[model samples]
Target: MANQSSRYPILCASFNQDNSGFAISTKDGFKIIDSNTGRLCYDRAVGAFIIVEMLYSSSLLAIVGAGEQPSLSPRRLCLFNTTTGAPLREMTFLTSILAVRLNRKRLVVVLQEKTYIYDSNSLSMLDTIDTVPNLKGLCAFSPSLEGCFLALPASTAKGAVLVYNVMELQLHCEIDAHRSPLAAIALSSNGKYIATASEQGTIIRVHLVSEATKSYSFRRGTCPSTIFSLSFAPSLQLPDILVATSSSGSVHIFSLGFETNQRTKMSGSFLGSILPYSVNDALDPAHHHVLHNAVSAGVRSYAVVRKVDKVADSSSSEIASCRSVLGCVLASELYLFIYFCVPFYLPYLYVRLPCPLPPFFYLLTSARS
Candidate 1:
């Protein structure tokens, strides 16, 4: 489909799990490229493609086409061999395919309000899921492909994240993440955690299913900024990182780790009041205040240490550096403003800085915002 130079062309894209290569689909065909060398690995003028995805095993690529009634139809879902431009499997369905996600174990196809999971090799239907109305066809496969997760709007409540375990066909948990519709959803590399952003895009909340704790909340900005993507930094080392890119032209990187200080703030008292203090942990005056902030904060990160844009503009023109504030307030009506709306400064300086910091030592600074 040669653009007559007037109409803009649209492309659908995705990267492989290992980040070795990426795949893109256009009206012309599907293409795969080596991410490292910028070399085209495979290209096929199969038909007009609407979506493309790669398997974690790097053995197959799945794509959805608009229609090739003569060769391939718009309803046909095709999986091709990555090494060779050979069609491995092709299936035609009745409805328009909204999205397709695959791992080493299974391939999931998303329809308007329904999802189907099939064996990658046999292409046999393993399970089918019913979603809320008008889901953006958003779903994710586990890191190991042992399970799957879907965040759908709650049938009863608006702006609720209905977490579903796609394998067992059960509801795992639900969180009232925001007042606005969800803009993006992400799963951690290990598949034990989930992160979500509201359509407003001012807040990011990470949910932990396996741990005793449930959620860690972070404020992305004072106002809404369109979030492009969120990802866990590839590492098996200390200080796990979660990076977020936005239309604001800033890349926010968060340094994450489990801290005993988080649990230091106790949940109980003589009258069961909302009082949090570091009783069990050492009370070094240096990291003392962080304990109060850690009562509800599970994932800890050093705040960005840059100038924040004070002028609220509908357009985000430049990038700003700001510290990642660590704060937690208990699940009570009294602390809602302190925990979620207001951003607190980091109590301690990150020993190893990931971003450039101000010349002044932030060690002794407090209440200076």
Candidate 2:
């Protein structure tokens, strides 16, 4: 049945750091699309490539034809100018490229059992590190232009995420995130937080890279579902807000807040004697808080979904049935709203959408800012 559905390998696609641009690759070809104007920045039906990624926040793109085409070997990687679709530089690898990630200063290429870091400009090799069997190509990069955080699997641990300082080439904190395979990994725009999900894709944990503290946890859904992506949106006034997209067709946004100054209390004094502080406060293992039955501020998440049914008309466009959702997460409460369409559009489509919705704190912001 699955073979009857798709004739070609599914196209690998991804968006840039700020969602301004996106890249898509299939055996048919490759193209970069602008998100704001809904236009193709560049299109190429040249090869049976399988991977396409944009250099963070830039128009530069990288494409890899690992195993999709045999005429071109699996090691060839091409960097192209998205504005003109001109090949800037091309390089070959010792093995197939499992995954490719780009920041402003560096490009990371992941193989099956090794990872390569390269200077984005010169495309020169910076360093190489061995890894455990990472078949899914699990990796993450901080969203900032000065991206220094790179999280990958540990070589010895079964399910540990090792954070590395790319510039210093030194090991940072390591989080024993899960015991099973990881479904997705994401780093905040400011590189202060890293969110991870296991293969179950139900529970997600956000950790402080410097302290390895589990600051926030989110349960995406009731039953197990495939997590499509996990992202940290930037905001000016928010603490930690994360967005997780899943195969369930819902975007789950989670916000986390902590008791301010708890860790930095000026040694409380009662009678000239100072209050006792725990020795393990810095790297204290967070009390395991699973998604189920966990308390959250205000509303947890709002989901936008397409109202389609088994008996729905096949000719109807899926976009015609999509409904947008709104949610607000306060310091102590979570509010969720699911409605039909926007105001003026109700006359045309009868949808109850928020025409100009108020800001819900800073669900999107750099952790550093």
Candidate 3:
């Protein structure tokens, strides 16, 4: 049973084993909501901190975020038992955290300039990789559980991605990617395609470990919006790309497809855009005005909810089931906006929408009416 209150936005959400319930991180803390009861069975405040990124194993949850202070210091990592919101272990580091990923065997953490690998069983540090030039981002193990890859955005003269063999800590392949620092990196579940985006909205798709080399680009228009995040849906049945733009508070979804048995392409019209659904939309003018003003000034964050079954359908259909549903909600001031405020205001706020407005003549008739 899904939560009955469709009006409230979900801060963070993840599925459970039976696929019957979810562990949701909200402004309050963490809560386990029974899908059948639509009631929270467990809830607790892990800390006064906000969740920057979260990963879950079969019954464990790993959350990483900044400390309670405003500084460049590294964030703390906490592991919790999904069934009970109980803290299992906690660890601290030195540099700010960039990403966190938990595989079946190990937990990987990417800091300001280094990568740390840990033993998944004891949450103990197993080894560290600090030789890489500049570690920009981290992609956890694929859905197939083959291995994980590390993305190096920094190159002496060129931009490239360094694929690392997770178990051996050995460099696998270095491919010339882009001319500028990579803004986002993602790998398809099958490990067939690798996509990277830069400051500009230009997306580059490359065939991974293929000798018959081929690549393509998807122009996302002249929206000066930086791609802050990229993720490939973890479902093997429905392989799609999810891109988080710095501009509007929306997550863009694209279906991955292969053309002519060679090049890869991102197709399907604009899936669906998530926006803050104001709660005061139907309230009285005076009261609504106040609520609207408060909401506008408050921090807003959007989360994209993609049902695993939806992705599964794409594998069996020819036309590609492009049906996408969007869920939006407000986030606490600390997590959603504090750290990203400057970037969001300076670059994202001015991004132009993809659609064009009607001509002046078309507007005249509406004005007369």
Q: Tell me each candidate's TM-score.
A: 0.64, 0.67, 0.58
Best by lDDT: 2
Residue pairs whose backbone atoms clash in candidate 3 = 1-35, 1-36, 9-329, 238-311
Candidate 1 per-residue C-alpha lDDT over 266-360 given as tens digits, one digit per residue, 9 for 90 to 100: 33434223433322222212211222232122221222111111222246653222233322111111111111111223434322112121111
Per residue, candidate 3 scores C-alpha lDDT tens digits across 1-369 of: 013223333445443322244455544456554433344556566433334333432456666543544321237777767566566887877765666666566677877567888877877677776634444443434423464554444454454666555555666676776676565666554455666766564444444543314343444434555554454544445334333333333444444431221111211212112221121111112110000111122233332223323322446655343233222222322212111111110112222122121110000000111
Best of the candidates, TM-score: 2
Q: After superposition, how far is residue 191 of candidate 1 from its true place, in Å?
A: 0.6
lDDT of each: 0.52, 0.58, 0.44
lDDT of 2 by residue, 1-369 (tens): 234214433356566766555665556776665543445677778766667888754668888884756744567778878677688988888988878888778888888898888888788898898878887788888746554788987743445798987777777878888776677788876788898988677777778887988765556655786666676655333334465655554556454422122334323434213433332222222221112211222222322211111122267633222112122211111111223211111222322233222122122211111
Ranking 1 against 2 by TM-score, winner: 2
Error in Å for residue 4 of model 2: 12
